[model samples]
Target: MEIKAKQLDSVNASAHIKIPSQELKNEVQNLAKKASKTLKIDGFRPGHVPVAVILKRYEKQLQNDAEQNLLKNALNNALKELKKDSKELVGEPYFEKFDKKDEEIDIEFILSFKPDLKLDDYEKYIPQYSEPKATKKEMDEKRKELLKTHASLEPIKGKRALKEGDFAKFDFEGFIDGKSFEGGKANDYVLEIGSKQFIPGFEEGMIGLKIGEEKDLNLSFPKEYPAQHLAGKEVVFKVKLHEIEELKIPELNEELLKKILPNEKEPNAELLEEKIEEQIKNEKLLKLVDEELKAKFADALIENYNFDLPKGIVEQETDMQFRSAWQNFSEEEKKELSQNREKAKEKRDSFKEEAQKSVKLTFIIDGLAKLRKIDINDQELIQAIYFEAYRNGINPKEHFENYKRQGALPAVKMALIEQKLFNDIFFFSKTNKKGEK
Candidate 1:
């Protein structure tokens, strides 16, 4: 056997392989013998069939099988010779050409793989941003919101028109084209006036209605409404205001604090306020880290690194992105896309650059993980799966099995590794700054 590798580009290569005819002939003879043991002849016993008869009866089939096996072995050997693994391949290698001449069979294969990345120095390319802090005003607002969660609703004392922020209990029936539609009527429905839970003008029209008052709201559904039949159509809601309720927020005193935190040995107003402030600060910081810092860091990394992406990998990533984005669309939007395939194609095409970037980033991260010896063991993987299951309110065992069936466990592990890498970088920066101080 002889093997030669040629670099087609940064992310592609070609391998020319040749196998001696003598080796193939030997393999073909071995296969013929194996097949002969299963043969049933009228005049000969099984396993006693003559080699000449076997060759005469199944020569083409045996030779084809031998060729297939030889090609597979040769490709594996060629990859090993080039210091590559089949797992590193983006897709199956393309059989560009093959031929047989005299005593040797020659074959060429085109292979796609991840390109080598030259990452820029992280300390210089990644930006620095100040950690977010929660202000007193923000803390106060959060505290109020938290209090409202525990508040009780009480009926209003006097005859007054409803207003925004008031919870109204009402009965209503909606009609389009002077005919009632499905899901157009409800009895004793409780709705917040400003919640926007109902269609436009339905809640707003009830804002000035007094108890026991009935009003007809005439409104038009937005053209982009999910229900195609009702979209852009005018409808009338005959609503009767039955009762109005207002929230009575509790005072943030010792009794309320003790009720909120039953395990506290010595709960006080100061401690409660401190806890609220700390919670708000942590929430804000996390939001800043994910939405701002992470995005900026990723963009900087992309700008600093350069590599050609494997075409097959990029196409797969792009298709995945397109499907994900399409799944998130409203029914109306999906209908529009389905009706116009060109528009859908344009949408998919728009993701090409982003897909390339995403594929490149995965390669860069994998390379860094290798260099840094970042790894996730079985225990860590199980723990991560359990955590994910808990977050999604699913059974851990079921989630694990689902991931395994979809072949997504590796993707999960990669996500965990990337998260760990980012966390390490963040903490390292913080520690280095403190050391400088």
Candidate 2:
């Protein structure tokens, strides 16, 4: 093992790591020896396979494992030689190159760590403002809306033509050029007139039709419709309006309270009002506090913590942003830009400033979290992911694994950490200042 490393700066380093052929071969053999004890293969008894057979049969996998093992070893040795603790490391060490030749393996790695930020007193950035309060009138309005959501659907008292916001019970049969299509007919389907649940033109076509009135709506399926065969094809739906309906809003009494808040020990108007007030207060607090004060404070902190960012990371961010913008360009635009090198450089250069700021803010946040001892553990992160998955109706394990595979788990964890850090800061400050005159 030979490692030649140089410090690029206080927080960045570069190294050339090497492992001779003999060591790699020895590692592969060791791996094969371990695999022989646990592997099961055809024509061989479990835990009794020969190491030679295992090496020959799983050569690619063994080679990969061996390389990974050596890389880890190289990292540990490099850390020791550099006099840098593993705890101070930041993002994954970037591999500049990994070359495997007949006699040896060569690797180039660029390592970085959290900079020693001399951040100023960030508390001064916290904006001073009167905390927002939920008014009684607002709570009363919200409560009325909540009770209306629990309202029952009832037949309309006065018969009238269908209109936007009205609900309709109708029967519809669809046809393509006089021939009926599969899944083209339904009976007694209840739909909100302007909900847009149906294809475009279908809901609008239902307007102005009275109960018992029948009308034929001619439409073309959108080009991107899910049904490939029907996409961009013309169809006509013969719809007959059967009933008109409206929401019969209920009184916020005991019966309605029980329906809305089942299992509540005290399902009364007072309890409902309290819950409503909490909801309104939270909404206002987010708008007034998080958006206004917290955002302003973050910008101020970024300006206050003036420090140099890692150049490699900043360039990487700029490149990523430029490539993303390129992907969104129209093909003609891409062609024009590709033909004009100077113009393309200008396009890419526009992203550099923002990219620098973004990279710098990330490091600033990282240092601030360390200084404040604000941290997010693996369990807390996974719980947040699980809650998001539940809300979006996805399997939590699958979502986690998907994020892990895409190498996006770090970004997600960072986002959670940022949210946690900001919330923790604003919360305590607000609590301490609660009794201020």
lDDT per model vs. reference: 0.82, 0.84
Candidate 1 wrong stretches, greater than 4 Å: 6-13, 18-71, 83-107, 110-126, 259-265, 303-356, 367-437
Residue-level lDDT tens digits of model 1 in 252-287? 887888877778899888887888887886676567
Give per-model CA RMSD. Answer: 7.6, 5.8
List the pairs of residues colliding in candidate 1.
Answer: none
Say which candidate scores most in TM-score.
Answer: 2
Put down candidate 2 lDDT per residue, 129-184, tens digits, no spaces: 66656787897789778977888888887767888988899999999989999998
lDDT of 2: 0.84
Flag regions of model 2 displaced more than 4 Å: 16-73, 96-108, 116-120, 127-141, 179-184, 220-233, 252-278, 284-297, 307-323, 329-356, 366-400, 420-437
